[model samples]
Target: MKSSLRLLSALGLSLCITTLSAKELTVYTYSSFTSSWGPGPQLKTLFEAQCDCTLNYVSSDDGVSLLNRLRLEGASTRADVVLGLDDALMEQTRALGLVQPHQLELSNWPLNPDLAWTDTDFIPFDYGYFAFIYDAHKIETPVDSLEALLNSDASIIYQDPRTSTPGQGLMLWMQKVYGDDVQQAWQRLARNTVTVTKGWSEAYGMFLQGEADYVLSYTTSPAYHVVAEESDQYQAALFTEGHVAQIELAAVTAPSQNVELAQAFLSFLLSEDAQTVIPTTNWMLPVRTDIELPEVFLQTQPQRIGFSPEETEAGRETWLRTWRNAVSR
Candidate 1:
């Protein structure tokens, strides 16, 4: 009886060890990334087949909020990977040392060099230009530039600069357009706003509901309507002053015990399968030039407007203050 009991104990211990080895990778990301329409579901399905591990997503409001939450969690963070931050937030994120450097070789991947790859920590996954999306059916004449957006009486919906990436992009884009007079520009633009939301999804939803004439959204947003809904009524207005290109990124956390698994997933992000999933799902441009984009992508005349990591880090607080002061008027 004693020998049989000891044998059962050994078998139970082996089973426990086997179960513990089945890794569950925790990914912290923006809500949009894990949305039904986003590439998250498809990508998760694809990666899981090869990984022999389950992916667990803990989605936050947006990229900034994700980073803020990580900061709060610090060394005790459960996130093995984070997949929504943009280049604008790179410097700040790197400074915190919240994530480990992505050790992947870019030359071996489908990585785009035009993303202006600067940080060794954040890996570029997808990108798009910030633009005012308007339903062509609603407005006869869309605003052509930031100057027109400010001068016209068209009601717009935008995210708040404090909480949203697009909102941050607008503030920075305005800085590029108006130079030292950005505050005056915001004051003028604020009069045209219907309401400010905390994130991109909320602002875009209001526009879609006809609550506003235009929305602060990506140039690629129309591609979703063009391809999936088979509708061409929505379009991004070309701007003379230019649009800010936002490159969304992914990074592995330093505190994660599943580093190899997290890194493997990061590698999978650059795969052709993942790149193919981005355009219509995330409504963003794939980093790989190999994928054939939907024809609606032709409508997006994206202008490059980005800040270096150091430059963004330095002026972030001052720019947010300017945005606050302008909107208050």
Candidate 2:
């Protein structure tokens, strides 16, 4: 009878270990999640509960840096999945062959059916328009357009595109607006500049701390200031030319050993619950059309602007060179 009891106990322990092992998955993303208000922990908890897999996050301060790391790690990368890459870096990600096609079960997703990538190389999770966030109290006539920023007296803060994703978005925004004459646009913008930071957090933090009157950030930036920071002074400007919209995407890494689990996580990210959480925490508009936006978002709807990823990829180097020249001049 004692021998039988020992065998049962061993079997139970084995099952527990197997369960624990099956309940873990690794994800890599941008480092915005380290904050209390960030979406990392909440997403992890929800995904784990639904999929029975624990999410292990590895994050970096910039999306480009994260992609670079994935390239460096190659097939031996510890991450099963990667998130937070925007359309700007899609070419680099694809060229590096860092990610593989994920056939997610996305029946309930309310994405723009025409806009969704047919190849399934990456799935867009959330998106928002890039704009300048400024203190309303400081400036009497706030810069209302991209051109206004170039012509404004108020100091401007922005991130360096080579090192930051928002910076890339802003650069791409200029390219979209200025087109072939982008060099001239940068020349004009450089004249009214304060200085560039390394990332969005630094630029936005400095703006909030009164270091600059205006900082380049997302349209939803003011949402956080209004709701969480409770600062009525901050507001995101609406550019007459329209702001550049960046779509954040997630994908299963090519090296992932557990492709099915990674695909399940990707599908979950597009679900209604996850989409609902995106606007509040990540300060991004949901890609899932069915998700009801918060009251704050309803009041400040971001203007939609379009740009070709191919155009951005082709012109990025030239644009940056022109911007550098403009800044130096």
Q: Compute the lDDT for candidate 2.
A: 0.76
lDDT tens readout by residue for model 1, 1-329:
22332332323212211223437999999998899988889988887776678989999888888889999999999899988998888888888998887776665554576765656788888988999999999887888999988899899899887788898898889988888998899899888889989998888888888998889898888889989999989888879877888888999998988776676777777777788898889999998767888778866666686576678889999999988887886
Off by over 4 Å in 1: 1-22
Error of 1 at 143 (Å): 1.2
Residues 230-295 of candidate 2: C-alpha lDDT, one tens digit per residue: 777777888887777788889999988877667667776776667778888998888866787757
Indicate the worst ten consecutive residues by lDDT in candidate 2: 10-19
Q: Each model's TM-score, in the order given?
A: 0.92, 0.87
- Which of the numbered candidates is closest to the native, going by highest lDDT? 1
Residue 294's lDDT within candidate 1 is 73
Per candidate, the number of residue pairs that clash is 0, 1
Which residue pairs show collisions in model 2? 23-54
